[model samples]
Target: MKKDLIYSLPVLLATACSDDAEPQSNNIQCIHPGEDLQAYYDLLTQNPQVVAAMNLCERPASFQTLLWDKVREAEKTGLPPDAPKPQSYYDFGLEMETKSLSGVSFDSNQYQKIEMVENAEYDFYFPAKDGEGRKLIISNQVLERATETFLRNQEEREPIKTIYTTKEEAQEIYAAHLAHSLWIEKNEKVPWSIIDYNSEQLGELFGTRTWFKTWDEKNDEYVISLVLDHSPRETWKVINDIVDLEDLTDQKAGVRGSAGYRYSE
Candidate 1:
């Protein structure tokens, strides 16, 4: 659960709340990892948990601290008897990756392994993708730990019948999930303040109200619903690539035009 940190826009600060009640540091600039940091990216590629903690982190140190906290929690809960608890981020990552890969019942040769370094080999290996659709690169872990927890909680319950969930409930869950992700990744305490969004410019996100169209099994008809236009990370990546390509093409065109011209001809 997120802390109820009240954050209003700069314009509304005066009328919305008393000056004494306002929290300090309303706006803060965050530094993201750069593309040139090959060593840092390599470390992240090896550690999936670290990557999860880094998704929304403002500073690089925040993710390491988050991972350390998790390790401390695991220790307090009691690891297996005779199991050595990890003391650092590198140790914890290695231990978890090893534990996740143990007791595998299927052939692992079919899947691609994530390498620690392109030019060198490592002792441990993490799969690019598990049987499920989870990606080790972006996801916390490829094993779908969330599903595992859900199954464990429901183990003693009666056989499943109807699964019920509302759009409002889902929106709250979605927002909380993203909020938590930002906290874990970026170490941002308040969800709303994690990304300094211009509330006035974007207004409220009506997109939260959009829902997927579901098929009515009993009526045998397609249920029409408000559709959400997804702005996925892959979409932005493709957009950036397209922009780079266009710039390169323009440069080539300029070069060709210049080459065609001769001095005093």
Candidate 2:
């Protein structure tokens, strides 16, 4: 007969935090000043390794130069003339807004193109804030995929496999054994001396208790039994009352539960 197995593993638990950061509003925004912009551009240009990492090439470079020209013009006039700016320019400006608030500053109305690459992933470009010539780009592609793959592999490697067997079988076995055990615990009240003694002997006899053989021909009757351990008189009475012995002899037609029991013809 085909059977399904069900098992459980320990679950991880966490305590809720008493305090958490409040969410920020979306509509309100800030911009950077001109001197801060120049400082940001100077820092990126100074870091050759950072530049190479972002994959900044001719077009991005030329665009960045134009942005610098625009920044210089903004400095001269203290205002920017309306013109078509590269997407990179807006992206970098947003980044600068965030970074500048965090102690980083850049020139306003200038543009700088930076590429960010990490872990063999495609590079992304960010333009400086408000057409500032300094942008922050990060190579996030590789890192994201690597983290996902690691989690997937970890789950695949777990040792325990949860099984869903036939529900009828599980219910029968659980009811039978549970009733028997409860009866013994309630009625006998065996002295600690006898109880302890019996436990050692029984523990050795039954390594672990699992569902017993089923007898129901149509639905597969199941019962639970202690391995090598005889049931006490009271316990046996409860088992006898709950379990149908005749059902144990018949073959079960189907299995149920989450892991789904297998049936062989």
Using lDDT as the measure, the top candidate is 1
Candidate 1 lDDT over residue span 1-265, tens digit each: 1112222223332223222222224342122223332233344344323322323222123432332333333234432111111122122222344322222222367545554332233323445665885766635453446325433433445322222234333323223333233322233221233123333321232112222243232354332232221222222233343443234344345345444334323
- TM-score for every candidate vs. truth? 0.18, 0.17
CA RMSD per model (angstroms): 21.5, 35.4
Stretches of candidate 2 above 4 Å error? 1-165, 189-194, 198-265
* Model 1 lDDT, residue 209, Cα: 28
Clashes of 1: 4
Candidate 2 lDDT over residue span 28-106, tens digit each: 1111113434453343334322222222221122333333444444345443222332222222222333211111123
- Lowest summed-lDDT stretch of 10 residues in model 2? 9-18
